[model samples]
Target: MPELPEVETTRRGIAPHVDAARVTELIVREHRLRWPIPPELAEHVTDQPLLALERRAKYLLFRFPAGTLIVHLGMSGTLRALTEAFPPEKHDHVDIVFDNGRRLRFRDPRRFGAVLWQNGNPLTHPLLAALGPEPLSDDFSADHLAAQLARRQSAVKQVIMDNHIVVGVGNIYASESLFRARVDPRRAAASLSRIEIENLTKSVKETLADAIAQGGSTLRDFVDSDGREGYFLLQCYAYGREGEPCRVCGTTIQQIRQGQRATYFCPSCQH
Candidate 1:
């Protein structure tokens, strides 16, 4: 699954080419996506200029005067900016061609991705209305999360992973952030002290920012808009290093199943 960093990377990569460009045509090779690409999508955005391209959580918003085009990459999707002569691959589902002969291509093999139209304020849309503060936003502070978790009995990892508490803390990032903060994944959310919560917050921010800079980790099908795999996987500490020697301590890292997800931690280093 492409997380926040990967989506942000895609936004940055295609923004320069697509933003402010006038849409000449929209080609839907396959409309049967996760949500069945909005039927009137092609007709709606035909001659409109792309006002802006921004990312909210895991979805990308292509803003125009009338409305916004919302895109979610689901589990395995890639967006690429290409020239007219660029060859389309097997799974290329849609394309937004500009007047300049450039196109933004969307490829998703699993078809779990979506392309929807919004005629009103995108933030107020039901899909995005209740989402929590962006993890990178100034509003997502330690105090903010601490207050949200004060009475929650859920595991600290699960609490942070909750979209209502803070958006974009996916499974990969949750494990990495907890490992960096030296917090056990199974620790109760309400049991955290102020200091521990502060450390966890900082670790989450740093981990996400670093991953974004690195173009996101390519553990599976994730890739940058340019089709290059991310290099951050080479620097993972404990996420998938089960039974391996801990990077900080000499103890062997252990793996456990929590909520049916594999969690990795150092027995001696992470309390």
Candidate 2:
């Protein structure tokens, strides 16, 4: 699945082509996604000018005069900006063609992504209303994290990964951040000291900024809207390095499963 960095990269890539451009058409090739593509999506967004583009967590928000177009790049979904007509591949699900002939194409092999239309405040949308603060925003601070994790018995990794605590700290980033912070993935969130919490918070920000700078890690099918693979995978320290030498310490790295997701760490480096 595309995480925060990948999604943010996509938003930046497609913004110039679509922002302030009128939506001449909205095409839905597959309406049966994680949520049905709103039946009236095409009708609703047809002639509206896209005022701006923004991303919340993993969802893409295309602002318009009427409402916002909410897009979730689910498990195998990707979005691209196309300048010319290319043959749609097998899973090419939707296209928002601009009046200028640019199209924002969405492809999802698993059909788990969604393209929904909403009127009024998008932040209040059901899918977005309950989401936690954006990880890259000022609202997500060490003080905020410490307050949330004060008495939680969940693992520190798990707590950070929880959308309720803070959005966009996915599996890969979580493991990398925890390793950088020298915090064991299995450590209780409540057991963390103020210094540890501050370190963890800084690690999270730096890890994500690096990933975004590298255009995000290409796990499986992730690519920027420009259709380029992210280079961050080559910079990983502990993720996917089971039995490999740790970058910080000479000890071999290890991998374990926490909440069904692979967790990697350096036993000697992470306490």
Q: Write the per-residue lDDT of candidate 1 for residues 1-271, one digit (tens) a residue.
A: 9999899999999999887899989989999998888889988899999999999899999998889999999899999989764777889999999987789999999999999999989988788999999999898999998999899988998899888889998888898999999998888999999999999999999999988988899878899888888877678888888888989987999998888888888878778
- Stretches of candidate 1 off by over 4 Å are none
Query: For residues 136-245, what per-residue lDDT tens digits would candidate 2 score against the true structure?
Result: 88999999999999989989999999998899999999999998899999999999999999999999999999999999988898888999999888989999989999
C-alpha lDDT of candidate 2 relative to the true structure: 0.92
For all candidates in order, the CA lDDT equals: 0.90, 0.92
- What is the lDDT for 129 in model 2? 95
Error of 1 at 197 (Å): 0.6
Scanning candidate 1 in windows of ten residues, the lowest lDDT window is: 81-90
Model 1, total clashes:
0
List ranges where model 2 is wrong by over 4 Å.
none
